[model samples]
Target: MASNKPAPEAPSRFGSEYVDDFATRPATAFGTEYGADYATDYGTDRGSDFGNDFRADETGPERAWEEWNPTEESVRPVRGKHRVAKQRNGLARSSTVLGVGVIAAVGAGGMATAQSKPPVSISLPDSIADNLPDAKSLPGVGALFSGGSEAEAQEAVVASAPLTTAGITTAEAEQGSTDAGEALRARILQQAEQQQDAADAEVKAAAETAAAEKAAAEAKKQQDAAEAKIAAEKKKAAEEAAKKAEALRLAKLAASYAIPTSSYTITSTFGEAGSMWSSGYHTGLDFAAPTGTPIKAIHSGTVKSAGYSGSYGYRTVLELEDGTELWFCHQSSMDVSIGQRVTTGDTIGRVGATGNVTGPHLHLEVHTADGTGIDPMAWLRARGLTV
Candidate 1:
């Protein structure tokens, strides 16, 4: 069937198989189709032109070889860059080390500064500096900062000054301690001496008081003994004076009385025994004398009788004031009359032997008022007259 579309062309080895009657063809197509030498000519011509262009655009091989050889100027930039990079790395390392060292130094310096400046100020003597170690010889202080700035040098100088000054202060403190010890010992010695003195004074005072008391007691005892001696002497003298006064009173009474008769010899006592009398014993004392001797009155008395009685011739009786009778018996004569008064030493009668007499004597008798006879010798002696 004939359709109104164009017919499909066959696949050719050169290109699209469709051909136009008016289309232009390439020159290489003619040579390819005819298998001619035109391809060789064209290749040879282009090759020649390429050779000519290469000759015109580039230098010779000798010149290129010469350009490729390295020179000092050519290597300078690379080495410079490498050297700069190495220097940068070195600077970085140095900076890092410096930073760490600065931090450590600051920490240590802060502690040192704090210790050096105390709360209180202490000034030390200059002589201590002579004995100190030199700051330049110290390890991390002076030598480490020798090439550093002026501020670092000043810091080292400041750090070394204190150690020398502290040595002088220690010597002064030792001297002060020695002086204080001596003063304390002296004060203790003074107090002990004062206490000892006070004790000695107290002992002395007590001894004095005891001695005074002993002296007073001795004096009192001696005074009492003397007073007792005086009282005994006075009593003895008073007793001797009383005995002398009694003896003088008896002497006066004897002088007032008298004896009845004198110059007569006693022949018989009142109590004598005889057979010559009318009674059993002798009743009267006998005074033997010559006849007519005077008889005296013994004391002042009145005559009661003067007459001859039996056996008593010419008798006389005298009565005294106390009622005692004195009888002159056997008298030769009566001198005193009846009712007559006679005194002591007066004549009352004469001695006789007329009353149955043995011899010429007076027979005197003492009787009471009732006519009873008593001893005549005892009656006379009582009046202080010795008979």
Candidate 2:
């Protein structure tokens, strides 16, 4: 008879404590895209189940196997999505590897070109061309994606031969002794220096202008002062010339005239108020002297008369060309007759007590053409003769 009881599960070949494939293991595709580092982490997948899809490393020594329960995770089929056993997956992995290799090759070439290295061109033998027929026609992997100069980059696509994908940039390289940034910096410094030079020139021009203005101002001041001094000297010279001319005129007039009597005293003047004269005023200039004092012609004139009257004893009359008359009365004796032309300083008579007078004197009278009497002393003084 069999007992209706459950049988005990057999122990695993490795151990009893087992690891959950999905719980404890790091997730990894059997074939990852980077095929090179794929196996590097596989051995250390943190308690991975060897019985699962991961292939054990054949080159290293065998590692101890861990226990694995026959649960759904372990007994289920391993994910064959990226397995090399699957033809489609295998093709995809191969294509991915080729693309990564191409990208790496292009990156290395780009770095070398950036370092100013010479580009490397490729040559494929005819036998290798048939093996990689799609290499020249594929979109990203085609020769059009490869890099070179402008002419060469364009030519590479049309070229039947394959070329290396040396990563030259599409934009043209700048040609100069220095890069753009350094050149721009140099230009900025040059502009700054030019501005500084212009500023200096402006300052210099301003200084020169100021100096010129100052010099011009100084010259104007000097010129003004010189003009003033010259004007003052001219005025002084004119005044001095006028004074000299006046003195010469007076001297000439004095040379042409004479006094009426010499060594005589001026006892009476014209317009004197006295009781002795019948007209109540002295009408002539009186020159009192000794009885023998000689009387001279007052100026160059013709004597109109020389006579002895009742009160004016031995009187003489001198007439000028301009009708001015000089009467010499109270003369002791008359030397010139009427109409006698006489010169200045010629003796005409002598002093005497005449004209109902009290003493010896020569009485002289001056009258204009209308018989209007004037002061004899004033008339004589006007001709530069002092009596």
Question: Which candidate should be chosen as best, given lDDT against the real structure?
Answer: 2
Candidate 2 weakest ten by summed lDDT: 108-117
- The residue ranges of model 1 lying beyond 4 angstroms of the native Cα positions read 1-250
Off by over 4 Å in 2: 1-235, 278-280, 309-312
Model 1, TM vs. native: 0.37
Query: Candidate 2's error at 84, in angstroms?
Result: 88
CA lDDT, every prediction?
A: 0.63, 0.68
Alpha-carbon deviation at 277 in model 2, angstroms: 4.0
Model 2 earns a TM-score of 0.41
Clashing pairs in 2: none
Per-model TM values vs. the true structure: 0.37, 0.41
Model 2 C-alpha lDDT per residue in residues 82-158, reported as the tens digit of each score:
54522354466445544433333233222111112234467889898778757646533455455545666566545
lDDT of 1 by residue, 1-387 (tens): 222332232233222222221022454663564223433333224224224433211323221111245788766653232211113334553344334333332332221111112133566677987778887677336735478667776666676644433334445445553344444554468678887878887888788877877777777777777777766666666666655554454466556567767788988888877687778678877888888888888878899988988876778888999899988888888888989988888988888888688888878789988878899888777666676
